[model samples]
Target: MTEMVKGYNFAFIDEYAKREIRRKVLKAVSIPGYQVPFGSRELPIARGWGTGGLQITLSLIGQKDILKIIDQGSDDSVNAVNIKRFIEATTGVFITSDTLKATIIQTRHRIPEEELGDDQILVLQVPYPEPLRIVEPEEKETRRMHAEMDYAKIWVFLYENIVKWKEITIGARYPVMVAGRYIMDPSPIPRYDVPRLNNARTLYLFGAGREKRIYAVPPFTEVKPLEFEDHRFRIENFKGKACELCASTDTFLDEIILDDKRMYTCSDTSFCKKRGNNPRVLKYIDRNQQ
Candidate 1:
């Protein structure tokens, strides 16, 4: 039993290690947009498998806290489900699919539909935290560029691309200027999640395990998605369609391709999977007749 116990619970990270992570988190919260480097631990989970998010969750989870997790906006997505199970197994904390019930949420790729309040905290798993990563491959160079707010190269690159392609030609993981100081990666969240970050009520934290960086956006921070005055900001969507399963018009819809029959249905799979029977999802449907 002693030998078996050696490989489990908190993995290889000692209590001191966790305390170090807690210290970095505190610094991240105190100085918004400033990157705090921490000694990241090797979890049982592999790198880029939401390891950063899991570390933040482990460090901050108090005895009484409800946790919610989502990947690409779906609770049951394999990565999200696995991470949720792992955290629950380690902490014995209750996990909820409902966004509102959660005090702490760790997410990848998408933000939830519900508006977050100041009481909640959102943790983002960032594959790459450096916004200047494309322009300067070396971490050392990017850090210098950020310190000087030298983004002339990024703007020139974008301008050249538009000149050649007749459009910006970039989608998802778009760069943004945070607090008009640091140019930050808003993780890989869809463009829809970009606007939601602007002056949001919730505290937002980003962690990159591979890079050993942690950062934050305090409540009411100015997060501007990279854009032009004439171009404005927008999110992609299927026009004039509602979810077939939940019939939600306002929710983000996933296009489901039905086999090779050339037929498709608009469905908000997350909503359908969560609350199909709830009144909010089924209000317009005649369930009794069915």
Candidate 2:
């Protein structure tokens, strides 16, 4: 067991791989929203299953950094638990379910409901980094289009969506124009979380292992979702629904079906737990009463 453990570095990845990733991360940060290419190493995990986010986490993590891993807003999910355990075993870093206590957060699908501070960093797992992939399959052509800021095709696609669906049919992975310069996918985060990425206090990094790309949204960067002037960008509307457990209306809720009875609960478990014990719940209740 001791000999097997000695075969791998602190994060199971070698120091050279970490340094290369760090260098690419710096470049990604320097030019926010620009997808920097890197040599993605094969981990014990499979690709298309969060190898990108895992690589990023393993590279940037330190002994002092408090890491939090979440999948679809739940830390207790299978993917989250596995990644958390892997990181803990390798780096010996303190792991936390509390969003506020986490220095580094690796998330898939959902962003935390609570506001992230400037000190925090969010690493998103991206299956695809290119927003124009649906429009153009060839990567070289897409790169050219991005270089010339030729998003006319994308705009036309959005226009078509309005004409066909009466609303932007993109449920998630909505494309956004980042920093008024480059167009980005913002990963697979829901449209509700897209607004949170705009001018965010925390640094938002995205990694796509299969795609071999890394992108970033630095603090205070602009991130405008693609939409026509007539058809503005919108988020998922719960239609007057509130979490059954927390009784909070101002949070993203997951619909729960128990015994054919539909109910809503906060998608973010840590945020829900915190808000349940917080006095702010009283304020929310009082405001509703008035």
Candidate 3:
């Protein structure tokens, strides 16, 4: 933690609200990819500004928990810095930019490039929680579709994308089938990060404050992106380009233009720093050494 504040509870929320949120989180974990409704409480921050994830983190955090907050894979960004300050002030818990040291990581928009272990919990900030909403507008109709496991319309949506663009045009928020059951919107994570969700060690918790929804993906769960036989799902390819700073070819690279020249860099800042400092990481696998 940066520094502890005198006023406020250990985790900033009352005991009653914490218990309720915990119960809802358990239900979401029991049924993977199933959206569980909860009573979203008003926080100090605005509703659409990461309140859902902040709420979940507040509910789950303990004294021993080392938290990490990131926005779009950066630690020093405006959103990340503000959220980190809020969390450390309220909880007084240890905060780290090092991905491996964090027991609970609250993130928006992007998952860390380093693989998370079973001991870690990743709390993702979701703007929208419903995957079926793309095809069905009403809440009742979407609930019915989930209950019956009817996903023909969403399938048609994908099929139509392939028909027109010759590929899946979804840039982010890729719809994935969780545990071969419910189709979930993986919270705007890119296609590159989609593959990391399948049978991973980390437990993923998604919170949508505005939507009053919470969902989870437990350890070793099967998460598959929607794809066909011929037109298979693919991640963004850099065409042999590597990160300009880290020289990492295997990890995801962000395209940048410096002085009218194309440059590629690692979106995960910690990953870039780790590789840039270590000479033995030539294998290019973005894993935490510690």
Q: Which parts of model 2 are misplaced by more than 4 Å?
A: 1-6, 279-290
Clashing pairs for predicted structure model 1, backbone only: none
What are the lDDT figures for the candidates, one per model?
Answer: 0.77, 0.88, 0.89
Sum up the clashes in candidate 2.
0
What TM-score would each prediction reach against the true structure? 0.87, 0.94, 0.94
Write the residue-wise lDDT of candidate 1 on 1-290 in tens digits. 01223345553356787889989988987877778888988887889988887788888886689998988877878998888777776666778877778999999887777777789999999898887887789978888887788888888777776679766656778887778777778888877678788888889999999888999988998888777666655686656776666555666666666766332232324455555566364412244765
Per-candidate alpha-carbon RMSD to the true structure = 5.5, 4.0, 2.3
Q: Which structure is stronger by lDDT: 2 or 3?
A: 3
- For model 3, residues 142-206, the per-residue Cα lDDT tens digits are 99999999999999999999899888878989999999999998998888899888999899999
Model 3 stretches with alpha carbons more than 4 Å out: 1-3, 282-290
- Order the numbered candidates by lDDT, best leading: 3, 2, 1
TM-score of 1: 0.87
**Which portions of model 1 show Cα errors greater than 4 Å?**
1-12, 260-290
As a whole number from 0 to 100, the lDDT of residue 101 in candidate 2 is 86
